[model samples]
Target: MFYAVIPAGGSGTRLWPLSRAGHPKFLHTLTGTSASLLQATVDRLGALADPASTYVVTGVAHVASVARQLPTLPDANILVEPSPRDSCAAIGLAAAIISLREPSALMGSFAADHLVRDTDAFVEAVRAAMGGAEAGLLMTVGITPTHPETGYGYLRCGDAVGDGPVSRVAEFTEKPPYDVAVSYVESGRYFWNASMFIWRVDVFLGELSRQQPELYAGLMRIAQAWDGPERERVLGEVWCTLPKISVDYAVMEGAAAAGLVGTVPGDFGWNDVGDFNTLGDILERDERGNVVIEAGDGPVSKPQVELLDSERTVVVPRSGRLVSAVGVHDLIIVDTPDALLVCPRNRAQDVKKLVDGLKERGTSYI
Candidate 1:
């Protein structure tokens, strides 16, 4: 059986103001659609797997929101993390729980906040990964890079693994400098590491046991108590003790070290949609290169009002709000009810610094 595990514990800090503590980025309707990023992820999974086979791994704090957003998903499918441990523990817990029921299940681990344009190509790429997983290979989809993006990690492709659409993983590189990223792209040897992994439950568990023994032991303790009457209580206690390491650092990187998994090319028009700037780039833009999202009430007044000689600038005004820009070129103006973000078009990735400063000030309201 094919199952999907959506990890929804990340607090998309980069898209602040619109993305707050109470409401994460996954819950935001940035695409001008009624559906949220989490709901969109679940919908994407529905196209490939049964709704019954899909699971959402999220923090206990987000349980109610996740449940409210996806009422159709089975209640048991919502795997609640007691605390924000990290992706490694979150995915390990999901694998353990799902494996308890379906030993031979092929589970696909995905981030809950990505923006994918081509659903059909995504499904096809996943099918190829499933085929590779069936052959005992921990398969990860490597996105064909459209640019020399330093924000994402790259996966170097090695030899061809099988006749199917999988290839041996050459190596994994974390986010590198601009020169390295450029060299990787120019060499035509690497793809953006999308972090979308597929493998059998036991295969991942075995790798965890081999590499992260301490984490595996902790997971075993929780797995042993997963079905008990004290399941929730036990989970709460155990979650706080798990380390805050990512799955890539703990497992996938280790798998590459042990020569167990392979990297496969995927061309699904994938974008992680990490920030508001990226969201603008992924969606349609006007002739002025503006991307707007209107929510809450009626259409935003002056949605595309031009000011003094500002060409090729993007202005996104919150509904029921009036926003005007003047003397700005190639800029992004995101005006929300609570906060307004104005930045140069090319410096969108640096918005995270503002979030860091806000966090430092203990402004929990975002």
Candidate 2:
């Protein structure tokens, strides 16, 4: 059985106001569909895994909302962290728990805020990765790069493994400069690291134990108490003590060095939706290349929205007020009841700076 673990613990500061601490980016519907990103993630996994087998590891504060969003998944499957520890701890904990449940289980960890336009291709890539996982290899689903993207890390793939599409990971490169990224894309051997992985529970845990023993030990201790009376107590005691690192740094990087990592190249239209610009690109655009997220609920008339001579602009109105834009190009305007943001599309990634400023000013706005 392939169990899916979703790590849903990001503040999404880059998508502030709309994505708040109480309700992060994954909870919103960036896609045209009404279902939220988290819900859509679970929906996509349903093709391969049972709802009961799916687990979501999120922060304690967001537990209630996560549960509310995914009622089909059992409450016990919603693992709650006492505090934020990066992906290593979150995914390791899920691996440890799955290791206890079905010692022979296969599992995959996917982020909660990704957008996939091609569901069939996504599922096929995951199924292909499972073949690599069965052979005791750490498998990552790498996206075939469509452009030279500097925002995401790149993976160097070597010769194909066996007869399958899986390739041996040559190296894991960090996000590079524009020139370097372009060269990588031109080589055609590099892929965008989508952070999607699949491997047998035991295989993953063994590598994790060898590479990140302290973190593995902490997770094992918590898992030992997971179904017992000491579940919360042990988790509270050991979780925060684990090293704060990402799974890429803690396990994947080392596993790649040891020649134990493989990647199945994917071309299933994937987007992380990290900021307003990315979100704008994913949303449906008008003839003038404008994406308008309409305001108001039910059949009630929406507020007046005028976009005159606007091109490639994103307008979101939630303040129940008219939003008029004229001669604006490649701008992002998000208005909520309490907060309003106006920024250029190129500066989308820096929206987090505004949140940091909000923190310095006061926590109330945030």
Number of the top candidate by lDDT? 2
Each candidate's TM vs. the true structure? 0.94, 0.96
Regions more than 4 Å wrong, model 2:
295-300
RMSD of candidate 2 to true structure, Å: 1.5
**Tens digits of lDDT, candidate 1, 1-366:** 789999997777777667777788888777767678888888988877787999999887789999999999999889888778889999999898888888878999988988777788888888888888888888899988888888898888887877877987767788989999999999998989998999999999999898888888888788878888978777777778888899888988878767777867778778887776677777767766666665524444454454566666666665346777777777778777778888887877777888888888997556
Where in model 1 is the C-alpha error above 4 Å? 296-309
What RMSD, rounded to one decimal, does every model reach?
2.0, 1.5
- Tens-place lDDT per residue, model 2, 65-159, is 99999999999999998999999999999999999989869999999999988999999999999999999889998988888988788889987
Which 10-residue window in model 2 sums to the lowest lDDT? 295-304
**How accurate locally is residue 130 in candidate 1, as Cα lDDT from 0 to 100?**
87
